[model samples]
Target chain A: MNSTIALFLLQDGVINGAIYALLGVTLVLIFAVTRVIFVPQGEFAAWGALTLASLESGATPGTALLLVVLGVSAAVVETIRERASMRPARLGVMAVRDVAMPIALLLIVSTIAPTKPALWLSVLLTLALVVPLGPLVYRLAFQPIADATVLTLFIAAIGVHFAMIGLGLIFFGAEGFRNEPFIAGVFPLGPLMFKGQSLVILAATAALLAALWFFFEHSMLGKALRATAINRLGARLVGIPTRATGRIAFALAAAIGALSGTLIGSLTTISYDSGFIISLKGFVAAIAAGLASYPVTVVAAIGVGVLESFAAFFASAYKEVIVFSLIIPLLIWRSLVTAHHDEEEE
Target chain B: MRQSIRIALLSGGVCLVGTTTLAQVNVGITVSQTGPAAALGIPQKNSVAQLPKEIAGQKVDYVVLDDATDPTKAVANARKMIAENKIDYLIGSSATPATMALVDVAAETKTPYCAMVPSKAVVDPVDEKRKWTFKAPQNDAIMAESLAEHMAANGVKSVAFLGFTDGYGQGWLEEVEKAMPAKGIKITAVERFQRTDTSVTGQVLKILASSPDAVLIAASGTVAVMPQKTIKEQGYNKPIYQTHGVGTMDFVRVGGKDVDGTVFPAGPVVVADLLPDSHPSKKVGLEYIKAYEANNKTPFAVFGAHLADCMSIAANSVKPALEKGKPGTAEFRSGLRDAIETTKELPATHGVYNYSPTDHAGLDNRSRVLIKIVNGKWTLLP
Candidate 1:
């Protein structure tokens, strides 16, 4: 209740909120492009953290095998679907992107990981291993039924979440891992001493946010993605490949998730099953933002984190209930205040 | 010549069947081998593997089942072991809930059950129903008294309590509450957290603000690491105490440098080498340590030693039954149950257990030893 204690709690809340913000943004992005709620976003973070742990221990992470399996299967499905009409050059290019690239990356990672590379290099390798599975999952599970109703896509996303959890258990085992901090030291700020990892988390979140802004604002591919997000059918009519846009959106979400995972894993001991709660918290923040507006989602995530901190201080035992219950009021207010509309006419 | 050879073969087969029925004893075990408690349960399984195969003159056959840390599965496993396997003795279940649930099966089936968890609820206030049950580990009540005595001896006047939100936490809180107030030590604050929680910053902040003389974290396993690391990172420097739940190497490895100076109570297996040569549990504890370390890839954990202690108790009782009657008979099992309840001064790895008809848990203050993490190794407190 004192000023010093309040300041410490505030700092703690902000660091946690920053991670939630990245997840919030990813949830909104996937929902916008694919009309899927993206329930398995937290699995990417678990995979990323566990993969780094395995790499540090000089063991070949099972995530590498998972990436190859998902990539090859996605490629096979795509090849079978396009076999009759696609020319040889296009098929070769597709094969290179979908199957060969993952295999090559797997070989490189398998060789480098055993040498126990620098922390930064290991993190990059982990991201590279985990990020591609996003698009591959989309292609295998969602792309074939791209025009399905939102409810159907939501159910599929849940199934994907469960499958990822099972795969995570196989890869990481039941044991939890706490990775070494990316930045190790304590910074003294007046009366409050900040952990180096906390500062790293805040800075990384800000940098990623800025990078996302630039990508969406300046690049042609960014604008095409935005166009697809706005109106998939219209964007397709205007020569934008919506399926490609969906793939790009999923890929970006995966990268964001893995980065957050690497940051959060250093701060806490994470198990194979820890992602579901974190994913639920991110979902809460996204719901607060009505699954739109990146800035609003970030702000709402910070609010969610701060509220949880205060609630833990007050009730302690009921902190989860306190944080989760906030959603009811936010939903009520959004429904009553904002204009509700159905999806745009087909 | 062919008819004479067939008659001899038939006579040899009959003698073989009779010898098998009299020589083999079945000991059934159920532990949480594949769930959140797997880290603890797997060690129990390892210890069972290291148990002396031939106790006394009878060959022991252990039937191991995985409860997956669920109470329902634990009960079902107990039923199967009692009914289908017709086990003469049972040892189980690393977690408290599962152990407590299995107690009913033990009572109903009239089979001697040895529980591995620390909660006194497994055996305290003994009655007719609990006559068939016994526990090997030092109970929370006994350990709490040792911790409280340690605090009082050090001139500590106030303490803060932090524990898991489930049965383990509640049990520690109750015992600490009973022990501390009796010694004129005031509890300044109490806090609880879930095992799966990723952060305890808010709880840590409040504990720091209260500024008690010491903090006692009552959580078990790797989950206790969160609060310990957070309190250290937040710069709360005072005596920190943990329950025996944090005695494993995984807890130390996860907490790392943060656990360097923390003090706690643990079974003698944790500090067997550091104890005085005359300590009662030292020799048996050292024997268990060697046997466990030889078989397990990880460092010797107290859970395995605790399970070993339970198996020792079961074996001791089975020896008497084997001498009195044949194996796999109802009379032998009933006699085993009666013999276990009368165990006296039986030295094991954790402690010398003395079981009676009225009290089943058999362990006392002697089972607990005060241990501190000095320079990352468990050092025995003088």
Candidate 2:
């Protein structure tokens, strides 16, 4: 291929890689803290993008109703599980945060969505609608089984993934939606032109990465989360509130997923079932890093994106096969390189 | 009081006697209602509400099931319907693979089957298995011929090909290969992508590198927008041709301005209002569109028209078949098959059908019309 075409493909790869990197990082964080593979991470992104599209079209997004339903279910599940230790103040807090907050958000969105609010307001509302779904899902599906084996948690994540996909279909309908770009236009860079939205995605990814680094290196909660990721029992023994840390990890993952959805939604169509493939790509990146190192996951995600683009250029029919197959070699390498350890002994 | 009780008893007895003699015709329908093909199947399911409750003086019973786009489930559904429901007619499984799965069951049960998919393999060569099968959509070859003719007329010499990797894409690719070559057009590039692919920039780049005079996208539904949009974004502004699979309003809605100039061959029903009064399908197409929109409380999707046409063909055959035997009897099913095969000059939503023993698809060149998307609306091309 000519250099110009190669550069164009590179630009496309990097843009896609930015979104995949965000998802990969989230996958690592969630896996580390919760021991869950987070299969439903892409659903959150799909919900975010579809929700934004709904708002932009002056319709009340179904996610608002979903939030309320999930919130009520989470509150009920948490209350029944913690009944023995529940206090009156804790009950009040649960009632307000779990039940009241979603209803309030629903009311506000219902009021402004039909008015076709500004793009920024619609995006803010989308985040408000989708981000809480993460912790709510955690509270309802994973909290009771927090100490379960990784396989059990992974199975539960898959169940949640299917449930969310079904719910996504009901909420968004079967038609695919593409949102207007947050930014429009293109910038000429030597032989190649960069789309404005692609630049936005790159800038956003870098900013999010820097912010995450700051949070982990400087913030107390981040250190607590890191401690929990290192040793859940040890963190709990040191009064770290492991359940809270799990919720925090989920919330961050959801935020990242939602942001990625908004970024990529403009680049391609977003359907109810579109999230699985996107997140699967991210999973490939996480696996490439052995699900441990954040920097490695990000860098590997970009590499995966570049490889996928070139594969598509060369063999479009086998693009997916090639992309997913990379994980096999990476897995073999990881197995040979890393020393084996028994988790039960730990 | 005694007289009134006697009169009620007499009427109840008459009703019971009448119910025993009333003919009942059962039809089984299976479509992908909740999976990847739901966009196509949901409309077909919705069109079921428009089907006649009674046909040819018989009570028509419809048993609709969702296959979820799984071929295994489609087979199971077909077997269950045949065994339990004792349906004489079968229509279903909106996609090709699932629809093809039902063919064996249809042949084994000797049921008259109507498929909504466009693949010619569903019924061709009049094999023993396919004798019981028929389809509503225009065959891919017919539509491909229309597209190739349009390209040739416009002075296009070479074209790039992009389509799905599934049966639909491969089927179209084969047709395009045959049609384009006959029209003396060269295919410069061939690329395939999944329906769920998030990007086609790489494929678009490859197509651009080859730099054909035109592009033909053989995908259906909302996914068809991706390659066109990518190609446009790359500043390649040559003519682009799409297949009939993208005749849905959702395609126009999703593609928006990017698909403004897209030209494709579609069922005449899509542009029913614009079709001339002399057109054979205009009246029937408009009526179906009106009824569908009113019943579904949404704009009529072109996919739904396929099912409506199937129902029309079934309705026409049922009248003559009743002369042979009872509705549930094997004699009646064989008679129905013969009647469908003998169907002549029957106009439905999509087009007029003239099915024969050798041709179960029944649609001709009149079924297809070249349509261009202009300002988010379908305009009939002269």
Candidate 3:
């Protein structure tokens, strides 16, 4: 409650808020484009974290070079998948090829230069579905329910939750592993103490945000994607590959989620159940922002994270009480505000 | 040969019917096994369940009930274990709430209860610790004192405390707080959290803002892990301290690498990583790990392994009474207490146990040591 307490909480809030923003952005992107929530995004983070220690010591520095080569192979694989999908008679082949690309890319690239081979290998097995399975989800699950209520999309998301939990257990195993501190140095400036890891997280988050802003402001693809986000029918009518834009956004968000997961894992210990906790936090952030607005969701995610950290700090005898208390009130408040806004719009 | 042995046992039993048939006593134990706190409660349950099996020659029936970390359910189950099951002796009463509930029943029925609750109230029960009541491990005061001593030894001058605002955390934190000033350690910031909290950021940031030399989180089990994670994530790079409650197996799994450099005040068994090869305690720990893993088909928790050893001593106390003649409940209780005290060198899996009536737990001040998590493994720093 004092300045000392408030200052650190704010700093913590900013870090937490930024991470939440990244996650919320990912969730919103997939929900809008694919009509699937990609409930397994948090698990991808957990897997990335579990593999960080190995990556620190063992991954080949040549992976960046290898990725360039693999990108061409991946582009070719996608062309083949597109061809198969066009043939109504061989629809199953397209499905198979679509599901094979992400896994294939991870395996082929990782095998050649994996630093922490075992950990990265395990993570790849858990998360390779990030790309290839999106279309299959669209064709098999979402296509049937595309015309259903918004409530139905939410329900399918809940089902995604169960499947992701099972996938985490099946791939990464249920045991928790320790995440070594990514930062090793600390310096104090009078009243303020700083951890190198915290600095890295903050700095990296800032850089990512700046880069994203530039991409959206100056780049052709980013502008086209934004246009696609605004009006899908108009974008398609104007010769924009709206579907392709959606695919790129989905892939980028997933890769960002992968980055977040690796950073989290690098920073803490993790287990298969890490995603359940993530889902709870991310969903709250999404809802608090009305699940539509960009800046609001980011701000809400970080604010909630800081509040959550404080809740965890305070009543640890029942640490969960703090979390529920903080989020439930915000949710109720948001509902009231949203209702009032809807009445005004009407 | 088997038919002949059965006929021999029938004849011997008939001859000793007046003596043996009146004795086969039953002891009841109730603890959690499957809930959130089951991480700690399960070990106690396993230790209690294994008692009869370990002491094979004794004709004792052990009745164990799983409360699964629910206090109301635990109290209900305790009542069933007593009133319905009609156990002759009661050995467990694991958590503070559960043990407190059972104390009322034990006092009413005048049942001798060997306490497993890790609170000061267990020693000085509300109506005063009955002559029938005995404890097998260190109480809150000892853990507090040991923790202070451990912190002092490492040159930790200032500390921040984050504890649950409940009986267990409050009770132990008070004892540790009172002892800290004398040890030259200052408490800079104090924060309270419910045991079920999911984020400890506010309190952790508060502590981080204080920038104290160290932090001690006096909460138990899984509840202790989250704040530890968030604190480090925000990059609070000070030594985090924990009392007896947080320094066990489950917290390690929860906190992961965030717990590295976090220190816990614990029994000698926890800091076994520091024991020299020549140390007898080291040998005991090694043997216990081997024997326990072999018997249970799972890795052993330090607390659970210690609990099993304590029970072995308790059961050994009644061996002579069982052999000389079948002894009743009171006789076994007193004999067990005496048996625990009489062992000059326990040759236990932990260390040589030495106890007296005044020291019911059989652990000395030397029993507590400072253990730190470095990277992913437990090690003794000093």
Candidate 4:
């Protein structure tokens, strides 16, 4: 292509790549700390985007009800798990944290979101409501199987993905929603015209990346999470709470998903089931990173996005094929390089 | 009381005359009520449910099944309806692929099927495999001609084509090319994408680079909104056109301001209120709108109206066949097929259908009306 066409393709690819990078980082985070692939990461984005759309339309989103259900179930599972040695004070605290807090948040969102708060504020509220779901899902579906084989954990993650997709359908219906862009205007940079939403996506990705860096570099909890990621058994023996670390990692992943969703909400139409495709692309990027190395995963995701953009310009019908074909070679390289190890029986 | 007595006497006389006479006309319908096409298929189901309960003094037993928009399931559903339910006629399948599969089942079983999809492949070529098949929706060829004419009239010299990479999209592309060349309109870009694709930015940018006078998107349902929104966001200020596949409330609701001024061709049901009173389809279209709104609590979708037209066609045949023989017999099925094949100037919803042995979808220009989306509402274009 000529210089101007190449420039536009680059712009489109970078904007899409930024979102994929956010998702790739989230996938890597969940896989590193927890042995699960976190297949439902895309659902968080769908829920986030759909919730924002509902709030914008001055309607109370069904995510409020989903939060309430997930919260109650999480609390119930926790209670049953700890019932044999339960302290009354700890039980009460757990109930307040798991059940009462989500219900209160749901009530607050229902009241404020319908009054049509500022778009940014509503988006923040949607993130708050959706981010907790990641940890709640972990407690309900994954924590009990924490000691299981990686294969079993992967199967459980797939089950969670299906359940979330069904729940998403129930909440959002089959109709698709498109959110209003957070920013409106276009800027010409050199030979390319840059969309305002594209800038928002870049800004959000950078901000979240910096925040994650600070959290991992300075904070005590962040250090604990790092320890858990490095060696779960060793960290547990040394007094790091592995369960809490899993929750923190899942929560961060969910936050990243919600942020990514909000950033891209206005750029495309989102339905209840749009998450799987978006997450699959991110998964490809994560695999390229070997499910580790946050910076590399981000760069790989942007590469996938730009490649897809150019592919679409050249062969639009085979663009998906071109993007997905990257995985075959990557998989081959990984199989050739990484050493295989069988899991030991506990 | 008089109507009830007349019906009772008529049934009593028929029963006294012969037990082998036609008892009921069973119609088996398969629609995509739960998948990607549910927005269109659900309304088709609702309209089929509203079919007249009795045809030709015989009770009509209708069984509706959800194919989930899958071609395999659609074939399975058709087989079940034919073998187990012993249906006399089959009406089915909102999406094109499912209808194509169901048509195969109908042909194999020697049972007549009325397909609700718009692809000309359903009834074209007039081979033995398609002898028992009929379609209710206007063919893609007719709609494409209308689009080409509308674009040409609006001074569009060149156009870009972006459509779904499926039967629906390919059908529109073929038909639009056939008509555009005749209208002296050059097609600048031809792009395709899947229905579930997350973005069409690359295709939209390419279309912009080509700088066509207009763009015609040949996608259906909610998926159509993506490219339209992308084109608008990218600041392509020119005429934009869509196909009849997008005549749904969800398209309007999802597209919002981005779809404003999008020109396309649609069936009369979408703008039933806008048709002049002297128009042949105005009254029938309004009647369908009333029945649909009463049941669905929304305006009638063109797919639903197509099914309504099919029901009318089926009803016209069943009344004549019941006078001849029983519904489940081969003779009765043949009679029904013949009746549907001979459909002539039958004024129902969508348009006045005129079917012949050579032309199964015998709709002319009367079946299509040029429409534009103005302020999130369908408006007729003179």
Predicted structure with the largest TM-score when compared to the true one: 2
Looking at model 1, residue A60 earns an lDDT score of: 76
Best lDDT among the predictions, by candidate number? 2
Q: After superposition, how far is residue B312 of candidate 1 from its true place, in Å?
A: 1.7
* CAPRI grade, predicted model 2: medium
Of the two candidates 1 and 3, the one with more favorable lDDT, higher being better, is: 1
Q: Cα lDDT for residue B58, model 4? A: 77
Candidate numbers, best TM-score first, in rank order: 2, 4, 1, 3
The C-alpha RMSD in Å for every predicted model, in order, reads 6.4, 5.3, 10.2, 5.8
TM-score of chain B of 3: 0.80
lDDT of 3 by residue, B148-207 (tens): 877788788998888877887788678877988989899998887755333456676667
lDDT of 1 by residue, A1-346 (tens): 8898788778888888888899988998888888889999998888888888888877778888888888778777888897798788977886898779888988998899889989989998988888898888899899988888888899999999878876787677666778889889898999998888999999999999999999989999889988888888899999999999889998998899888888988788777777777777888899888887888899999888888888778878888888899999999998998898777335
Provide the global lDDT of candidate 3 against the true structure. 0.60
- Best-to-worst ranking by DockQ: 2, 4, 1, 3
Which regions of candidate 4 are displaced past 4 Å?
A73-103, A343-346, B1-22, B233-235, B328-331
* Interface DockQ of candidate 3: 0.18
lDDT per residue (tens digit) for residues A1-346 in model 4: 6887788888888888888888998898888888788888988888899988899988888888888899888877788888898899978887887888888987888888768989878888888888888888888999988988878999999999878876887788767888888888888887677878889889988999999989989999988988888888999999999998899999998888987887778887788888888888889999999887899899999999999999999999889899999999998998888886554453
TM-score-superior candidate, 1 or 4: 4
Model 1 bad stretches (over 4 Å): A56-62, A65-107, A136-163, A217-247, A334-346, B1-23, B323-330
Quickly count the clashes in candidate 3.
37
Q: What is the C-alpha lDDT profile of model 3 across A219-312, one tens digit per residue?
A: 9988887777666668789999765665566566656665666555544445555645665566678777766676677777877777766554
Score each candidate by Cα lDDT: 0.84, 0.90, 0.60, 0.85
Interface RMSD per candidate (angstroms): 1.6, 1.0, 5.1, 1.6
